[model samples]
Target: MGLRKRAAATVVTLIAAFLLPLAAQAPAQAAATAWTPGISPLHDGEWVMRDIPGGDQADSWLKNCARASGIACVSVGQGDGKQSIFHLYKCGTRSLSNFIDALSVLNNQTGGAEVRFTGPNVGTYRAPANPNVIWKFPNAATYDFNTMSVC
Candidate 1:
């Protein structure tokens, strides 16, 4: 090849060699720092309520959530009672403790209705009146909340 052509080829090769590895690593790096939607890094707790109909019950839930100082609530979507979804995340430094307290209050206010949580972890819980109940879900990786009845 001519010297000019050879020099240009070498430069292209060097550029690719330097850039390819970074391109390959982009996904892993992104994944490591990826943010889970509807969950906050600053907050240590999350809850989702799904399929709630718009009514006094939904209004009450939203009201209570808003009243809490550290809780953040998002309406994921709206639909018929069976299709609505609400997501709540803890935004306070003391969120986990506060969450339990809120849950206890909810349990009392709603009369122990069944609260269902689904995601990487799935379970059903009834809020106990006792604020001391040790409610722990260390795996906050992912979750969705749903309740057929008022909770």
Candidate 2:
């Protein structure tokens, strides 16, 4: 074959090799997104089911969580806006640190420390810091994260 054709073939092979690994890694990276506690179907005390209905607030429930938690939290509404479940993690100012701490504990056999925010004064803290935060869908979602604020 011509030198130009040979060169083109080599370039295509190199490109495929480089892109294949990244494509394969995409799912793993996305899997980590939902690895946060409570969502895992495997854990017992680590997860629970709650029911809350959605009414008006529909566009940005996570934003509503930020408003309600009085700290920082992210959320996802269920059943096409039927309910909402918030994942309250770091104080927002420190998500990177919390993610690192959580990943370490989750990857370890020791599991992770469960943080108990039972008292009214018990505010949002980093993961491994506040592992027991309300993550399940609320019993009665009023509309957005306001009613479902993580614990």
User: Candidate 2: misplaced stretches above 4 Å?
Assistant: 36-151
In terms of lDDT, the poorest run of 10 residues in model 1 is: 95-104
- TM-scores of all models? 0.30, 0.32
Candidate 1, RMSD to the unseen true structure? 13.6
What TM-score does prediction 2 earn? Answer: 0.32
> Can you give the lDDT of residue 50 in candidate 1?
53
lDDT tens digits, residue span 67-133, model 1: 5433334332232232122333322222121121112122222233332233323444432322223
Could you tell me the TM-score of candidate 1?
0.30
- Highest TM-score scorer: 2
Mind giving the per-residue lDDT tens digits that candidate 2 earns over 10-83? 99999999999999999888655532223322222232222333433332343344343223343333433333
Candidate models: Cα lDDT each: 0.37, 0.33
Cα RMSD to the true fold for all candidates: 13.6, 14.7
